[model samples]
Target: GKDKPTYNPKKERGDVVVVLNAAHVHLTHDKWNTKLYRWHTGYPGGLRSRTAREQWEADPTELIRNAVNGMLPKNKSREARLEKLKIFPESEHPFEGFPLVPFLPKPRLLQDRGLGWALPQHLALVRWCPPSLLLTPRGPGLGAAAQGFEPANPERYRFRLRTSPGLQGGAGRPVVGIEDLLTEEERRALAAAGQQGV
Candidate 1:
């Protein structure tokens, strides 16, 4: 973990060290083959193109440096800024002199966690329940118990209510249950309150 120097033209030039582990860098499917690096030799018909895989095979350090340079803002200072970028093919580097403080990887997507990734065991999976499903009459003496409302079950909360025979609603309107969708705990609570669920 190297410190990135602040860009200030007036102040003395500083160093920004960027260390990359080429072995661990993950690229999306087919990008290794499809992504191409092109450059010209400052002459007619001197264009050349090579896939990322080929470039990495040829020189991994240059490949990493080029990738990082491409992400930097294009300006007169771009070259100066790129000069500060130091890439290493592997984790080995001469950064032991500084107090290395490893940074936590900021995962932007599910795939960013790498293959077969998952949340920590201590973290609980939260299931969001719609307010309507948990709503109860708020009038005096009419709490959740009186309204026969309970926490929705993760398994059955999203399913459509079953239709009963000989019970039909308007042609366009659909008939749905109000309390029958409750889990066993909810039904037990309703039974305790002497209220029949739908």
Candidate 2:
């Protein structure tokens, strides 16, 4: 009959130890919520269950330890082997006394910026103006208009609704209808009393 390997805390087993940075470990999908850990006490009706997220939040080190322990052989030395594994929430560890090597994780990029689709390279972001201000006759693009400040491709952000050049009364003046300069009553009286008896 084969005998179970006895666990020895002092004995150095030729096994590889892996220490993962819990913060850097990226879990995929809903595994954090769906994956569960079930354990039973030695007594009857002592079943217990916990989600990976719950286990992690409660004790991050325990989650990794449980996962790794389950994968190893269920031998007497399993507990001894698990003692070698270590998981840390941060990149730093207290094993500086030993010759420790660093593990570099690959950088992951977002597949999309969530803007739906690509915008033209010439596009410029313009600040929004309220519709009330836009409805005014002397709104942004009217006479003597100051172009709004823009970052990156300022020219592309120009407001093309500028008053037509023909609408200008003079070099820098906007055209004003004659009615604008006269009141309705004055205009009517002036028209009726025109020229002393021409």
| Cα lDDT tens digits for candidate 1, 59-152 | 7677677887889767776787777776776657887687744432221211225444443321111111222222232211223322333324
Best by TM-score: 1
Candidate 1 segments whose C-alpha is farther than 4 A from its true place? 1-15, 107-198
Best by lDDT: 1
Q: How accurate is candidate 1 locally (lDDT)?
A: 0.47
Error at 77, model 1, angstroms:
1.3
Candidate 1, clashing residue pairs? none
TM-scores, in order shown? 0.47, 0.43
Consecutive 10-residue window with the lowest summed lDDT within model 1: 121-130
Write out the backbone clash pairs for model 2: none
Residue 119's lDDT within candidate 1 is 38
